[model samples]
Target: MTSAPQLLTDPFLQLPTATSVQVVWFTEFAGVNHIVTYGENLKQTARASTTKLSRTREDQQSRVASQNQDGQVYQKPVQRDIWRHEAEVTGLTPGVRVNYRVTSVQEDGKSVDSDVFSLAATPKSDTPLKILLTSDHQLKPMTAANLQKVVETVGRVDGVWFAGDLVNVSDRASEWFDDNGGGALFPGLQGRAKHEMTHNGVKTIYTGGQIIQHAPMFTCIGNHEVMGRFARTGSLNDEFDDTIPRVVAQRIYPDKSLIDNSFNTNTYEEIFSLPKSKEGEKRYYAVSFGDTRLVVLYATNMWRTPKLDGKFKGRYREAEKDLNNPENWGYGQVIYEPIAKGSKQYNWLESELNSPEFQQAKYKVVMFHHPPHTLGDNIVPAYTEPVQIIERDSDNIKAVRYEYPKDADYIIRDVVPILEAANVQLVFYGHSHLWNRFVSPSGMHFLETSNVGNTYGAAWGDRKREVPIGYQEDYVKLGDPNGLEPIVPTIAPLLGEDGKPMPYIASNDITVFSIFDTGTGTVSSYRFDTRKPDSEVLKFDEFKLKLSSLPLPPGNKFPG
Candidate 1:
């Protein structure tokens, strides 16, 4: 049998024109580089043509895992999010059909390639589009049933909305050991004729690349990819010391710089080579498919800075001048810097919103990392409190460190308004790491899809958290429907002013999973406990998207 190509570039296809599609792949022509070939599949059989460029230093994340057997901890090689060498092909007419693959050069001067995949360009939508949406796919190959779930998704839907968090951190532990040749193509089946049994009693399979290669995906960044670097204490303005900007914690000891860095999804980036952002660069941007317009925002950057307006940010530092406080001087300063709206990104976003291109789109959906709405009654009680400082563009207010204007300022002041005025219909965020959806008073949908990897609890809204501390519309809990009494909420306890149980409410399985159609006007929620593959849907039919009938054009984007 012919051996696989050494290294293959991802993102097998691109749409340059309405009908033309470009196919990209990798080959070891000079070094690890990309080769793209295209033609009208409609004209005779398309012939393969090629181009080659070395894999940028960051492109080669392929490595074998190794470990020390002292019962201490095993270490594995870091995985680049995607395959190497992506082809950005275009010049196709819209609504045309095409097929492609990734041809990669391996370390042995040989090459590897992905299975052939195909897609039909965006045909002018005659009806509201139906995009299959699912997120938080935390698959562990250790079990048999879990592996089945991966197989189950193949050919099941039109296209997939793969929100982030694709692997288990511990899953790569095998990289530290070698049951196979050198790498981790398959965790347990190294030389076996077939992969018939499960590993560690859990089902496992390598399906990520397979799914991505075939599906013309509308992907969203998830918290798991950046959860380690997420500092919820404040905002992205919070500073860190990594000049190189690491994505995932390369070595694992909770490196501080990993705070805003990550590469988990980078593997997907390499394999798929999706569209990238102009300023922040790839991973956070919009993707349009036919009638769908997906606005991808970067939320991890939002909740990084700690809440410290001009007066108090340095207050703790100044007090530590003598260095004898026992409690570190930086204790309350919030590790990152104080954020302001006057920065360049704010202006760029405002301009993007004002663009006729953005406004003309029928459906506008925005995706990022942090939740704009508070899910529980315990934390801030309400979503709005003056947390961020707004001195330039507009809006001004002040309060406690985490209050709306001070810490929460970015979401409300810099981002949300632009989306709202620009006619964006839905927003999706994941930093909180659970399934949640909050509808704003302004008739927009706020959806959060996290927990693809790990999970925590979610707090329900409490009337008290809203009155005393809430300032934003999302934080202010609206009354529950007549028959939909809320499941009790829970929040971690801290000494209350009165020293009582804070009584915050949070739910664990309130995860967001369901079939949603912009045309149907509703998202019926379902909870699947992946722990036991076929476990009954935990909360059977408890929540339903309260779709507002306010008429809008059919959307081509997803509310990430």
Candidate 2:
């Protein structure tokens, strides 16, 4: 007998507040009713039913056309509905553990009850808050083990701030749902799934200690969340990476009716219900908890390279091609929203940074996907058009190097100054999947510890030190070609007490995560070395930030 549709994952928490919190889960059954009962004890009392959001596909002709052996063309609509349910429980006391149970009725009329789970509401001011910071865990082999370590080390955390790239492909249901290969993401986070990973010829099964069951998770959108495709098949096939099958791919996903068409974060917007400002919830938002105020920005551009090869790279729209549409033509296009000067996100960010709540908070941290001072290859801007500064091919094979322009892009020229002026404590970002830290001359701390699932290699080596043999070809550098290189942290291999360099750990294979403890004012980084069979998670680095005490800047005060 076939199994009827039922609740497939545990009720996970999101968007925690002093007085309320949201619980979300997925089910195999569509249109089935579900409810969450939460209260002061494990026995539960308060109740809230879920609001069902169903899936919808585009019109039939939208699917890509294909030919059969008989020379006839056909298309199939590959749409399947997976139910996502959410319940926002309110009026709970802050900083108190609340018990909850998720009950669901399957399509077959069978009732199911989830294991009793508990979560505390977000803490108010003066309460100790410990947060786990991580990002770019796209269902890799080490993902389960890395998260398992978070629970092993920090025990219980108030919240998790994922700095983007939750999955490699946002629209792929299997990636978020069940990957038959035994890597269902939700089950893994809930501690019900395990993935077997082999490194350096040693094999192991990795599992996470059910984390989301208690701690809430907040995320930013990365380039992977924004997909590009012309036909409906692009949405169906997880492997399709080119721009839409036709000319316009950005705004054509659901339909061609909207104007913001370069790329869309549709799947991301639907999956998570985050806190919002007047600008809505999908892109930019702010949340205040305990003594800290976090400002999350959607500051990344689409994934296009400096050189647009027809085979593997993105191209200009047919109408915007060089020959046919000079009026709308451009080459080496870098598609992204303008977040500097007079852009919507910029204005919203400025207002938020200057607000009284932000200025008065003991800690101010800004998070986004792209890093302003990363040594990774993705840090290069594809276009310097209006600015006239561009990147050129360097002597190293597969490596492209460029000098910082007199007038930088909006992020550096605009955003950084505002953040420094506002006295933002730290900036957390991920895209370069490695752990590296840099402090500007002005004492601003920029930390990238994305080595969660894996790494994209490191931006190691400088002119003085021969580039690490493995990273030489891809090593990127900044500063005048003939002058002293900037004093930035070098990506060097760790050393053993014997005074010899340890064996290299390839970038895409490292596992790491970081934590911030407000009460102790310290950030601790822990890493798991797969090479050691009985290896224990080791604390690799620790740093402390001086809490801000100065009054708000002259014009940054928000009215009561």
Compared with the true structure, what per-residue lDDT tens digits does model 1 show for residues 247-329?
Answer: 12444425544533422233334434456668645555565655556666544331222223333233112122323321212
Q: Candidate 1 deviates by what RMSD?
A: 11.1
**Per-model TM-score versus the true fold:** 0.57, 0.80
Steric clash pairs (candidate 2): 229-244, 230-244, 230-245, 455-508
Worst 10 residues of 2 by lDDT: 463-472
Candidates' C-alpha lDDT = 0.39, 0.63
**Runs of candidate 1 exceeding 4 Å displacement:** 1-17, 20-83, 89-93, 105-111, 132-210, 218-284, 302-342, 376-408, 461-525, 531-560
**Number of the top candidate by TM-score?**
2
Strongest candidate by lDDT: 2
Query: Candidate 2's error at 6, in angstroms?
Result: 3.7
